[model samples]
Target: MKEISCALRFMFSAEFWAMGLCWTVSLLASYWQLVLRRITGRCEVYPRSELPRNLPTRPVCIVTGATSGLGAAAASALSKEGFSVVLVGLSSELLSEAMEEIRKRNKDAHLKGFVVDLSSFCSILEFKSSLEKWLTDSDMHSSIQLLINNAGILATSVRPTPEGYDQMMGTNYIGAFFLTKLLLPLLKTSPVGSRIVNVTSFTHRAVFDAQINEDIVTGKCFFRSKEYPYARVYQYSKLCLLLFTYELHRQLNLDNKPWQVSVLAADPGMVKTNIMQEVPFSLSNIAYLVFRVLGLLQSPENGINSILDAALAPSHVSGAYFFGGEGRTLRSSALSYNTRLGEKLWNISSNMFFDLKLASQATSSSS
Candidate 1:
């Protein structure tokens, strides 16, 4: 009886110790987050009143994922600044509503919406052609000055697109890659310098153990041959964008092209967006509520500030990442910048397009 009593006592002691450690860790994390928010608040990094006066009479800004979240907010703000806004998204209903909202705020803003799902290469091709036709049709082919790659997806379960690429990677990287390439000429033709804002994330720090494996392009499976974790996949996608942003900036600046091309990345910093609400994970509900209590977390308004800042800033600081709309350092994984990996990713992406060359041919012929 004494032995059993001692065993029960030992078990109770272990449980108490475990509970204590958990609470301690949670408290420390909360404190750290609070400190981070305080530090970020002191950084006044947004370009609030610094819009250039020499802006063209018909300056244009293209904002993807403008149907919702920071994309919608940024597009609306740019329209108020008198930009001819081109909004891209997959939903016509949401697009229409967003257009109406922008018009209400800026009656003179030339607002247009195009429906394009960033998940499919074919749809992206169509969207590219549509943008080209619109530009040619309107004679403003040289006026597009800003391209904001803001559209993204966060799925609970890993699903492959019709193109055999992971859905997250397809929408976030491949579509964005093609869209930026197609719009290069238009950006080059801007009267003033042109800017490209790639909306990446702080979550990219989580990619310490990952790489841009060829499976991201050709293989029909993900790691573990099961549904990929949404957070992990999203982080990988952002890492790819981050690497591309750096590489593209280096190449463009090296050439010293006619137009001063600057590429900057922005992280909205835990914004109140529907992406979190739509994440299919079981713990996502608790995570959402916790973020809600954090005072430093971003609203959609705050989220747009960084994107707009990168787009409108006069001084070109190319190839830098911005968090919360100001210049910030990234704690990226070393593997993310591995030249060999970046080259591999680029080659895979290039080949994917080449493999589907026939579909592209059909698209151009139809166009």
Candidate 2:
């Protein structure tokens, strides 16, 4: 009994350990900025009044996974800021409820709900079609100035999406990729500078242990392999997301591209949300409790401030990484800044997108 108890107490917790390490690193990563902000009492988020005077009369913001948690909080806040917020989620009912909740906050909130299952390529394509049609009908298609890829999940067990990819990676990274690419054209057309904010995680730094060579990122090695633990897989997905952010930033900021589009990644710190509902109950509960006691767990509204900082950032900070309450722009993991790796990942991901589109078309023709 004593031995069993001792082992149980010492049972390895990958998530807890990863989160703890991430917490320490993120603090050190942004510690100076945090102190500077405290001393200067500086705020980074641009209030509506500070937005460029030539803003589209109806600037639009699309937030994925807007039905709950950090996504929902961000959608609500954006709507209240007078942007025509498009709420994207997997469930129609929940999306409606989220829009209603946001409306309750601001009766005049301009909100539209679109059902999008980020795990399914077909579903995301359908959302793009529907969104474009609505924007055209409303005459606001070119007004889409912000895209927040905030939908993510942490499954306790391995699961495959309809496309035979890991569900967590699909929903967190792949789906966001498809959605952003499909909408990039509209964003590029915005007269106002457009911004794309990817909701990354602090655990993204945990991927340092995993060699980030071409094979690992290109999915020839570990990705989609069920051999890894769920927590590790989640970290991998976030790392890919951070890579995508940097890669997209480089692509859009090229001299040839005649549009002002900035790409940023934000780490929301430790927000207690339903995204971790499927985690081992006992372990997650204890971890959250400890963090709560330490005042490390923030609410969704507070957690989303980093994301908001990215959305509201000026056009100059294109490749910034917003973190913590101060919304200080900080450096991401060293691996994230590997231009060669990010370029390779981007090329592979773009090719995969084309391949998936061809396959989807073939299936349609056969039917």
Candidate 3:
């Protein structure tokens, strides 16, 4: 009884909680510092200024996962830069709040919200059609200067969407792929070279450990239990996303299209985002607490710099991978850059999207 009491006391004590929180924040801070140092050859948050005085006028940007965290920050930043910002997410309440915040920051800014549940591909398709129609109907048609795929989901157990693809892949890869494809025409309608930014992470390197077996892609792989760690599943999804980004860049370059559509990949240096809340267990709670205590960590605003830099940097060209913030080019994992891996991911995603379309059609016909 005494031991149990002591353990409970320790767990609940302010000192223990404070220490854990401090450590988590410090770890994330240190991680970001290291990344900035490597990419810029210096240690500091990617130093940036407000949008340049001579920047283009009335650029439009559509950003996913914008209700919170990196996505919201990116949209807010763009709003300040004089762009019409579209915030995408499923939460109507959050979307309203985000819109209000951006509105406050940019009084003349046109802020739109698309309530999208990215976990379902059908929902994404619905969003795509709605977005296209909305764009076409508005004066802002053909004004989209950038599309940022910043929204993501993390799940611990093996989960499948209604479309049969793994949940992580469905939200992170297939949804993103189809969204980009659907929006390509709108993106091309831009005045000049526009940008498409896909937010990825260093966690993608872990793909070497948990290789994507075919069974996993086919939904034949079962979740061992609900006890699986979310970080692992999240990393797998990012690995596939990074690979897909590389392949998409290659295809864009191969096509030699006249329009300047820059396909870029970026990672938000570690920040305190509630992304961990989706983890299956209580450890995620602990992790969040720890990160909150670390003063070394960045605010979401800091994390968005990389995505914004990649999107708006004047010098950036197509087919580049950028580390977020300062927007410098990054050397990704060798496997991510591997043509074979990228091709495999592309093939898998294409097939999955095809099936999703077929399934939707069959269901619609039956209904």
Candidate 4:
């Protein structure tokens, strides 16, 4: 009877409670640092006078998915900084609304809108042509200074694009890849040098499969069935973007060009955006709600802060992955640094684009 009483006392002892408290505190700290703080969005504001003055007097900054959210916020901010901003989106109405909001912030803002569905490679090609013509007509071909690949989508299911690739993969990574490649000429010609900021996500570390990556880029993979998780697909798309950023940076170095064109991946953390609108009543939704209530989700303005930093980064800042409101450079996933995987992915993507161009040409000739 005495032993039993002693055991019970030990179970409820101060030492036991102290140990438990320590564990709880440690867990909460880890969660806050790794998950919450990373996504909560923080920013350090630089006064207008401190803005990078090395750029052209009327530098050009192109922002994709600028109809709303981080892209819109970035466009408004850049315009206020005296950049001639080009807004890209899928809807003319949304583009006009975004432009109006930006102009309201900076009435002298030089903003132009282009409506192009990024989910479609053909549309990106059309946009590229139209953008080049506009640049030439405006005599601003040499003024291109920044490209923000901010457009992305989250799919609840695997829908195939018109080009027969997964919708999320096509829009988030492949389209951005092609668009940047197509605009390389203007970017390389920039007098103030250029920067390409690919808006990635921390989710890239969540789901990364090399085989799956190859399959998605080669158009041999589809998740239309319920077997694959749509959230994983989104993570994979971001992983592809990170890989592309690193690979592009490496290629730029290999080309040995004196003109600086830095490519960087920016993880915006967990911004309150429409990207997750497709997520149903899942654990993700629950977590999002908790984050919102806790005020851990970042605003669009705070979310794009890293992207702005990457865009204005110095020449030596190429190929780095930046995060949070601080815009501190951090090591990405192990796979992100795998040179072999990056090279393979780059080759596969280039081949896929080549095939797409050939197919388009064939269709046009047949027509």
Which is the leading candidate under TM-score? 2
Q: What is the C-alpha lDDT profile of model 4 across 1-367, one tens digit per residue?
A: 6645644654455533443344234324423554544476532222112335665357888999999999999999888877889999989999999998887778899999999888787898888888888887887645478899999997756678888788788889898988887788888878666789999977676544555356766334665353444555667788888888998998998877733788988877777777766543343455567667856577898988778777666655688777655446566778878888888888888888888888888988999
Runs in model 2 lying further than 4 Å from the true structure: 1-49, 52-56, 209-227, 257-259, 365-367
What lDDT does each candidate get?
0.71, 0.78, 0.70, 0.75
Model 1 agreement with the true structure over 20-102: per-residue lDDT tens digits: 24423433443454457668764324344445558645677899999999999999999888788899988899999999988
What are the RMSD figures for all models against the true structure?
Answer: 8.2, 4.0, 5.8, 10.4
Winner on lDDT (2 vs 4): 2
Candidate 2 C-alpha lDDT tens digits along 226-329: 44466667778888898889888877877575338888898898888887676555656777797788677889999998888878866767777788755476
Clash pairs detected, candidate 3: 21-290, 89-116, 305-325, 306-324, 306-325
Off by over 4 Å in 3: 1-57, 218-220, 224-229, 279-296, 362-367
Which ten residues in a row are the worst by lDDT in model 1? 15-24
Off by over 4 Å in 1: 1-56, 141-143, 217-219, 280-285, 326-334, 362-367
Q: At residue 166, give the lDDT of candidate 3.
A: 71
| TM-score, one value per model | 0.81, 0.87, 0.80, 0.82
TM-score of 4: 0.82
